[model samples]
Target: MENKQRLIGIVLAILGASFWGLGGTVSDYLFRHQNVDINWYVTARLLVSGLILLFIFKLLNPKLTIFSIFHNIQSTIQLFIFSIFGMLLVQYSYMASINYGNAAVATLLQYIAPVYIIIWFVLRKKANFKLFDLIAMLLTISGTFLLLTNGSTHNLVVPSSSVIWGIISGLSLAFYTIYASRLLVKFPAILVVGWAMIISGLLMNFKAPIWQFSITQLNFANVSYLTFGIIFGTAMAFFFFIKSLNYLSAKETTLFGTIEPVMAIVASAFWLKVSFLPYQSLGILLIIILILTLSLKKEQER
Candidate 1:
């Protein structure tokens, strides 16, 4: 029974990661080919996905009230902060990075969130500074330099805006990862995340209303990609990832989550015909190695 459960967890984790990675590629396609508006797309995606997640949670836990998070003043404040700074910022920055760069570069850059988390811990003195931590930092810096420069000091393979947005994506993700944990302990993941997304979506809609899209932007291909991103990529991906925690250890699930960036890189190259120079490829490999090293270190500590 345990073995079977583990197998199920592994499959769910892979599916979740695949959706996320491929979703980024889909967004890239829409941005580059369809010329979709990023603000409207992100707003609609968050709103729809959040509604779907909440609907599912309500079905599964009919007795639990979704509005309970707002019952407390402190939780309400934290939720608002997380909605804007953590969830909204991460989504907008990631999509902006993809718009300015290819999905592969954007995804890999976001993978540096773990490095940011480590730095945050060290700065706060919450974690002991170790030799491996320094090595990880160096590896991250070297890999980022190569990725941006592609082995040349004079030329940049990706735009400066892409790099900036990608770094913000990583920082926001680190913030989300740390802050979400506290909310998750008191409320269920679905409740907290769903509420966060809806709040963020509503906030974003103030800047670019989701209902104001032109009819020309509602073509079959654009609609299909947006649907896929909202349903499979956002809602189902979050669902599967959270479900996998029941059967697998957090470390094992995290290790499997690495498949996301790999899938993004592969899908971008094959589907989008995005290419990377040899030095950039090497840089990607180093970042992958860094992720594995950190995951292993965590496993060892456990």
Candidate 2:
């Protein structure tokens, strides 16, 4: 039974990675061809996904009302912060990066989340130092540098604003990862994610008003992609992630989740016909190894 559960968890993690990878790729296409503003796209995905999960909450746990969940002032404030910094900031910054840069470049930077997570863990005194952890951190930083430069030290060209936003987005992800994992210990993962999304969606609507666009300007060709992104990419992927967490240890699950960047690279290459330099490919490979090394526990060495 243990082995079976582990296998199931692995499968779910892979599936979640695939969906997220595809979503990243589709996001680029949506922005380029669909005439959708990054803010609007972010808002729509959050609202749609959040509303669906809210419905699920109502259907399955009608006894435990969302209103009741917010009765505690601390929880409410945490939820607000989670929604604002964790979801809104991360997603908006990511989408903005794609708009300012391209999907490949933006995604490569976003993968820096792992490195940030490592830093967060150490700073919070949640984890002690380990030789491999430091090595993994080095690899993560180096890989990000190579990926940023497209494997050429001379070609390291990024706008100042883009660099700031990318790093901010990367750092924000650490908060989201740690907070969500901790909150999962006390609250239903789905409920936390749903509320986070709803709050993020509402906040984004105000920050980047959808009133800027008209229905007539909407790009119909991109609707299908957006629909799939919200339903399968966002909602279903989150569900599978939570499900996998139930079976696997947090570190194990996170290590598997690194598959997202690899999947993104492959998807961008095939679907977008984007090509990377040899060094860039090597950097991406390095990132994969680094994440794998992080996931392997010390006891596994025995």
Candidate 3:
């Protein structure tokens, strides 16, 4: 049974990662071809995805009240922070970065969150300030430099604004990881994430209501992109990833997640026909490996 479970877990992790990876490509497609509004898509994605996950939570754990997380004032506040600061920031910054630049570039920068996580641990005194952490940090810095410059200061590979938004996305991803840890301990992962999605969606909707937006053409191509962006990219990918956690450890899940940027880059090169700098790809690869090593060490210590 254990072996069977592990096998299932491995498959789930791969599928989850693959779906997530493909999601970036789909978003890139929409941005390039469909002229979909990034804010509107993010809002709709969050609303639909959150409601679906909430429904799933209700079905699986019928006894627990769905709104029970709000019973406590502290939990409610934390949930608000998670939704606005964490979810909203990460989703908006990431997509906006992609809009300004490309999905591959945005994703590679977001992977820098592990470096921020290491810094948090050291500052919090949760982990010893190891020499390896410094090395990992250096690798991340060097990787970013190489990716952006290819060792040349004269030319900027990505737009300055895109880099800023990508960094913000990375920082926001780190924030979500830390902020959500508390709520996740008290509630189901699906429920916590679901609520965050709903809250963020609602907050975004306040500024740009869904009803205000309309499709000018309403063609099949645009419709497919919108559906895939919400249904596959945002919702299903997250659901599969959370489900994999039931059988696998967080470290394993994250390690598998490295596939996302790869998928994004390859799809961008294929669909968008943008060639990757060999040095940039190499630098990103190094950063990914070091981040994995950092996570591995932490998991081992646990």
Top-down lDDT ranking: 1, 3, 2
TM-score between candidate 2 and the true structure: 0.88
Worst 10 residues of 2 by lDDT: 293-302
Predicted structure 2: clash tally: 0
Compared with the true structure, what per-residue lDDT tens digits does model 3 show for residues 1-302? 99899788878877777777777778877877777788887888789889988988899888888999999999999999999999999989998888888888898899888789879989989888778778888899888888877777798788888899999999999999888888988988889989999999999898777676676756888788778778778777888888888888878887777777777877888888867687877777776776577656654531
RMSD of 3: 1.7
Q: Is candidate 1 or candidate 3 better by lDDT?
A: 1
Q: Best to worst by TM-score, what's the order? A: 1, 3, 2
Model 3 regions more than 4 Å off: 298-302
lDDT of model 1 at residue 88? Answer: 98
After superposing all C-alphas onto the true structure, candidate 2 shows an RMSD in angstroms of 3.0
Per-residue accuracy of model 1 over 1-302 as CA lDDT, tens digit each: 98999999999998998999999999999999998899988998889888998998999999988899999999999999999999999999999999999888889899999888888889999888889889999999999888889999997989999999999999999999999887988999988999999999999999889898899767899889988887898889999998899899888888888988999999999999998899899899999899888777753541
RMSD of each: 1.3, 3.0, 1.7
Each candidate structure's count of clashing pairs: 0, 0, 0
lDDT of 1 at 120: 88
